[model samples]
Target: MEVTIIEDQFILKTKVFFNNQSLQYLKKITGSRALIVSDSIMETLGYLQEVIDYLQESGITSTVFTGVRPDPDVSIIADGLKLYRESGADVLVAIGGGSAIDTAKGILYFERKFESTEGKEMPKPLFIAIPSTSGTGSEVTDFSVITSEGEKVVIIDEFIAPDIAILDSTCIQHVPQRVVADTGIDVLVHAIEAYVSTKATDFTDALCEKSIKLIFENLETFFKDSKNTQARDRVLNASCIAGMAFTNTGLGINHSLAHAFGGTFHISHGRSNALLLDAVIEFNANLGGSADGYAADRYAKLAEVLKLPARTRREGTVNFMLALKRLKKSLKVEDNIRSLGINQSEFEDALEQLAETALLDRCTPTNPRQPSKQDLIRIYQKCY
Candidate 1:
């Protein structure tokens, strides 16, 4: 006899605080000692001191580790873990962009893994994440993209998700407009990819739909006027909503190729995702001819939801890509990788290796379209 088991679950364990309530929440957080993880950027912006001051207000003694960098790797995580042990803090706080949050998660993830492997038991510290950027959604997602050697390794585990996510849009008000454009595009990619992901359930679809709509409504406004509180709040909320969707549904090859492209070229993660979004969507939709597949249908649904002209699935998909391109232009992003000023020869030289690395990326398995290495290379070529 043959037996089959079916399973489905939606998890939202992280408590989220919106508006400017993050500082208020900090005052009430339980813990006598805290370890704050951030980066030099946050420090220079005076945000690091702000967090320390709030923690002090709550009578929580703390230690700071401001060594996190963009695209944190194993060595960086190792250094953070060493600090975490030395500091002996009962609470762990990550108060910067995705890099700081990912670094914090990486530190905790390795510690937890080692404990399980070595047959040791230890109580997990209270983990809190305050995102300075609306991108990555690392605060609520269990996925961590860490660069190891030369490849970006995505570590996904239930244990890595943060216990609390504080969304204070004011944190991003001082950020550069270019960063606003990059992170906002990343949000769109997250929602679109999640909506079309093979693992997407009804719950995830609802979140993605809301997120995509909000992004359309608010991203450009926020990018143009960083001080628009209304736009900032909406876009920041949209980013978290998209994160929730993709965290459940998982993303597609857009993220995989972006991981490879960013790791190889030392490009920003959000920009890498932005450059690959159009090509990946086209590849998955199988644009011109066949629009009968799940991917095309979902893409069409997105276009319809966004109120783009869509008489058919193929039309809807194309229209959707066009809308994304329009958005990119408005945000002052380049049309392709070539326009981003990467040398053609250098990009060409890395295509094969990029394709190979992308093929093995953790995000690839759930991609609606299973791509060959050549298929991936073709995507890179298209983006170029």
Candidate 2:
């Protein structure tokens, strides 16, 4: 199956490889020279070398850039661009977690942006994303989050989406329990947010529902036993499914809040999203509000998909929220931002700024409920 999105004169399409050794096919599609974008950890895990060996066997010369950091900023992009230019590679391969993929996207995005300004025509490199972690799903999404001036900036364009996504579970077999939990919850949040997004269509809804079910059924097993190949594959596929869903439908305020809070506090993106999920869900439902009940009805439909008991829409929404809380607890994720160990005074000082920044986040537009700054503040406080 394939999905296509047409927005503002751009067409976005991604090809996914599931449970297959995608590297075997790399030779068939790649250019003669490849620029590998990753972090040091990928090197330590030997995954980087494995990729290099595959490329070499395919007669594709490759150079390495391992400077990507968590919540990468513009500086990382600058560094990567320098490496990309020096390598003179015609293919760009991102291997590692979301950070690496996002860094590669940043490099490509800024390069294109610069070329446009200079009125110089530069062909985009063949971009392939190999996710070593089952989170973020950056491999299939047209969105990249780059932190600049203490804000997580969202860059969206069809050009940022990778030409191919390699979803081999072998790459994630060594993921730590903490990351498994964090990224797993990220998949769930991505699914829920996309399912409730204002832009959701029947296609996105189906993908989101399937992704949510996969996470619920597989995350725990994968967390408990990282070597469980079946569980790992399921979760990895779920992450990609969620990624494809959100890329088309867009995410909601849960991601908006996460981007703001994470950029401000240096929290992991998935952890930030996990902490804020329940609060955002409740806010979006607006059970007692006089506004349109569409979001609430959607929430109930999701509950039905999950087989959660509900006598009414409100009851289903509440039950779904409870289920999420329970899942977080089982995964050992923190229930609230306060529990993540930010200083109370620091949090208080940053509350208003965070709320305001969240309101400006790109993900906010498709949120089922429009939120005032005060509303965001209250939600942050409630989570805190």
Which candidate number has the best TM-score?
1
lDDT of each: 0.89, 0.88
Residue-by-residue lDDT tens digits, candidate 1, 1-384: 998877787788789898765656888888989999999988988888888888888899989998898899899899999999998889999999999999998988899888889999767898999999877788889888888997889999888889998898988898788899899999999998898888999999999999899988998999889899889888888888888988898898999999999998898988999989988988898885576788988998999998998888888888988888999999998888988789999999988899988899899998998999999999999989
Candidate 2: misplaced stretches above 4 Å? Answer: 1-12, 288-292
RMSD of each: 1.4, 3.5
TM-score of each: 0.97, 0.95
Pull out the clashing pairs in model 1: none
- Predicted structure 2, TM vs. truth: 0.95
Worst 10 residues of 2 by lDDT: 5-14
Model 1: residue 232 alpha-carbon error in angstroms: 0.8
Assess the local accuracy of residue 14 in candidate 2 as a C-alpha lDDT between 0 and 100: 78
lDDT of 2 by residue, 305-364 (tens): 889987788888988888888889999998788888898889989989999899998999
Over 4 Å off, model 1: 1-4
Worst 10 residues of 1 by lDDT: 19-28
